[model samples]
Target: MNASYRGGPTVERILPNEEAHELLGLVTEIADGELAPRVADFETRGVFPRDLVRTLGRAGLLGLPYPEEYGGAAQPYEVYLQVLEILASRWLAVAEAVSVHTLSCYPVAAHGGDQVRKLLPDMIGGELLGAYCLSEPQGGSDAAALTTRATRDGEEYVVSGTKAWITHAGVADFYNIFCRTGEPGPRGISCLLADAGTPGIVPQQPERTMGLRSSPIAQIAFDDARVPVDRLVGAEGFGFRIAMSALDSGRLGIAACAVGLAQAALDYAVDYARQREQFGRPVIEFQGIGFLLADLATQVAAARALMLAAARLRDAGRPYSTEAAKAKLFATDTAMRVATEAVQVLGGAGYVADHPVERYFREAKVLQIVEGTNQIQRLVIARSLTR
Candidate 1:
């Protein structure tokens, strides 16, 4: 275990080993030197940081939890998530990109056939990027009702229908396509791994997002796109299960991102309050502002602890889906609240782009929506309790 201070309070981390400590230090260095400087420019221009993503992949930050034989670092889930937190503190888009790519690899790495498993090296190694295509325009939370259909053709499955809110749509080398294959309901779905360049696969224009503009999100139209039969992950009717399982881990990743974002906002607000004077004293010295900062700092710490608790359960091979949902729900909601208060602390400067809090405020919102909305997380936890 080691305690280190970044910009805000000292975070005491209980790492599994010395190697994990060194890995966090390395990630911090990369985040400061590589990610921080480019975030503003790339985000402002709505440019995807493809090369920066490649740099992370090359540095082994992209595949922290997969097996070493598959070119992954084989780190524990807890360590992998902390890496995401470190990256998100400097640049959230890149951290999210890493999380999505990791989620995209889960199907193949965990359930792919032998032939498709051969691609793990390239996918996990980050030589090839990937996308998870499970959400649809008509079916974001109701994943079982997804209308994307894949019919069996000679030696292939002809996929048709549109997937909405797909990250890395046009940029990924491969996509994990979850589609309907049988009768209506959860049992009808199947997963297919398809090459991004396959014919009839069209990526729509990127959405003009409020934040995380550096990471593109758009709908992908699969117009009778042909994917090999061998690309089917696990058995037919297993896609829904695979998708939910992946999201359990993905939610934890998002929780880590939220914690990092909130921590950054708190740190900035604290710094601003220390320097900005009001009534012949630093604003931070005032009881009104000091108590608010105290509450925000405590919330950030609690969120991090909750997220790490879920991750450790996962690393220990326990049932953590409900815990993951709880962490995601609490952390993201905390991020939205913390970021809003941070802006309030900054007054007028927070409303403008002059400070990073404005961006943080905007970015905090989508964390509550992605991976699974806060409402949906509540549903998951509720079901676990009753059942």
Candidate 2:
């Protein structure tokens, strides 16, 4: 069974410049040579690829959209998302890790005080892995109803609560902890940057996820963890706005990941179909398999286009939350559909680990659930329309 499937239609992208094109070429080279070879083994063992993430960081892939003064590449959002798409084509877990880490840096980068901005160098450089702690077990979608509390205790804030479904939970060097500081609503929330090694900040065991096993997801319990007042990311009562802003960009990242995953599935299924034979001819020559592959290819292309359009909007510094929602909703749904049909195209072969389609199938399902559920994305878009 070939674990790496690199064959696919060459996408023609209208990049902003030669530098962006070269950057993408570098990413493609790394994806094929590094990520493709190791994904299967890492995923099977359920081991986190911290070293590979470091490698990506060293190569400047981790902070593409951030300012170069903070050790980032200062690439546009459009270019950054393309890098994510390329990475995700080879390995979804790694791409998602990059996305989450980028998101983790948002609160400080966008709204941090002058004191907190000093940490951007390490965080953006990937020397310090970061996690965003927003969704509590009971407040995944209803973020405004969060129960976590942070009280001002002289020079420190005593944080006490559990953050759920946090990627890079135990392994991260720092976390962006969102907790209530005043009244019970979005207005009361505040963001705090806490060291993962802080006493009383305990990480629970990693969840046995259905896919993306190479990435860790767990609950982090803050048992009165004392974060210094200086660690506050933004002004008090501003965490909810910071979180929503970060999520808009995060949704674009997930949408790009979905496009890559779907492309990989379609490519694999097409390759198998071309070689697979029945009735004295290739199976792809038959209308049933041929049409399915055609539709899948078209859908993947459309999803990529939608995702890129949203990224371009962000690049233009326009309001793109609704567009990001639409892209995340469509691209992930397309990935699920494409991966499922890829399995069907391969018949019995896809059901087993002998082919990568099985892994792609499992991986695609989680994209619909993560960042925000497709249903939640619909709600965001619908509200945008009515509002």
Give the whole-model CA lDDT for all candidates, comma-separated: 0.92, 0.92
Q: Over the stretch 15-81, how does candidate 2's per-residue lDDT look in tens digits?
A: 9999999999999999988999989899999999999999999999888999988898989999999
What TM-score, over all chains together, does every model reach? 0.98, 0.99
Q: In candidate 2, which residue ranges exceed 4 Å CA deviation? A: none
In model 1, which residue pairs have backbone atoms overlapping below 3 Å?
A: none
Q: Model 1 off-target regions past 4 Å?
A: 1-10
- Candidate 2 lands at a TM-score of 0.99
Error of 1 at 131 (Å): 0.7
Q: Give the local distance difference test score of model 1.
A: 0.92
Query: Local error of candidate 1 at 81, Å?
Result: 0.5
Residue range 1-387, candidate 1, lDDT tens digits = 000113455468889999999999999889878888778788888999999999899999888999999999999999999999989988889999999999999999999999899999999988899999999998899999999999999889999999999999899999999999999999999999999999989999998898898999999999999999999999999999999999999999999999999998888899889989999999999999999999999999899999999998999999999999999999999999999999999999889886888888999999999999999999999999898
Q: Using alpha carbons, what is the TM-score of model 1?
A: 0.98
